[model samples]
Target: MLLVPLVYLVIALAQVQAGAYAAQSTAIDAARQAARQPEGAAARAQALGELHFADHGLESARWTVELSCSGDCARAGSRVTAAVEARVPVPGVPQIWGGAHVPGITVRAEHTDVVSPEES
Candidate 1:
């Protein structure tokens, strides 16, 4: 017989995905702010600091930020990015899922903020 608990497990998995998305979104916001400033050590630091605050609720790990000239990102501006994958165990479907199996959600987002001459 198909277990009904499995249905709940699927729902939980979806929730995890939401969490990942939220975290990445905050990271992007920080990147956008940083991009507005000129590429420099201090500017990057401020941007990253803001991002950390934004990711307070979401899982924050392996934060990444880069500055590029031309292409998708211009040097005057910068790109901010964050990535994380979290594995959440099914709450009520342990038996249905068999051992330590659960759902894994991975998310990544990039933000590009224009760097003003003075900001740089």
Candidate 2:
């Protein structure tokens, strides 16, 4: 009946949401860890490489690392932000019944820091 479809829809939404959150959590954690490193660019690169979340029907892309600094960036003189995008797939069954087409979901994560010049 109608109630049966409602239950299925809720479960599907929950799954996609959970995946999005997991991706965001991983990206944010890696970004924070990278910022805490004094190596600046090198650290950023490492963070980008390390950020990842796995999904069965979702495809994940590489993470982006942003640094707020000028010159050599030898010191932690600014903030940092990292973001990653993911496309989660929703099965066609739910979409056909719900007309949701909930075919894809995107997730992004960001982290900021107050870097001090002397924190080099």
Candidate 3:
């Protein structure tokens, strides 16, 4: 019987790990999409929209996204960076069923993409 609870815990932990991986991938995709857009509010909005679309069962309110550019952003050699952080709630077995109280985990991902001068 004790093994059953342990199994549940292991499964819950695995789910959390998987969620974190998914969030990282989402962030990378958002960054890539944002880098392709012009540097302005429109680009930011586009990135956020991508993040929202790629969210892996995470609460949007708990997610933070940042976009930045270094060097001549409008130039072909410039780079755009996107950072995403989120606190994901762990889906664990019910506590009433003798499950452990597992706190949430924070996951973050950042990606940099080169900008093409021709793109505006």
Report the alpha-carbon TM-score of model 1 versus the true structure. 0.43
lDDT tens readout by residue for model 2, 1-120 = 799889878877875776567566655664565556646544654444444344433333333434443333344555555555555555444556443444565555555544455532
Write one digit per residue (lDDT tens) for candidate 3, span 1-120. Answer: 899889878876775665566656656766676666644734564456455635545442255667777876566767877777766555642445342333567777777888866735
Question: In model 1, what is the error at residue 60, expressed in angstroms?
Answer: 9.2
Off by over 4 Å in 3: 39-55, 59-61, 93-102
Model 3 residue 86 CA deviation (Å) reads 1.1
State which candidate has the highest TM-score.
Answer: 3
**Candidates arranged by lDDT, highest first:** 3, 2, 1
TM-score to true structure, per model: 0.43, 0.56, 0.67
Candidate 1 lDDT over 78-103, as tens digits, reads 34332322333334444456444443
Q: State the lDDT at 81 in candidate 1.
A: 37
How many times do residue backbones clash in model 2?
Answer: 0
Worst 10 residues of 3 by lDDT: 93-102
- The parts of candidate 2 lying over 4 Å away from their true place are 38-52, 55-74, 92-102, 116-120
The numbered model that scores best in lDDT is 3
For model 2, what is the C-alpha lDDT against the true structure? Answer: 0.52
Provide the clashing-pair count of each candidate structure.
5, 0, 0
- lDDT score of model 3? 0.62
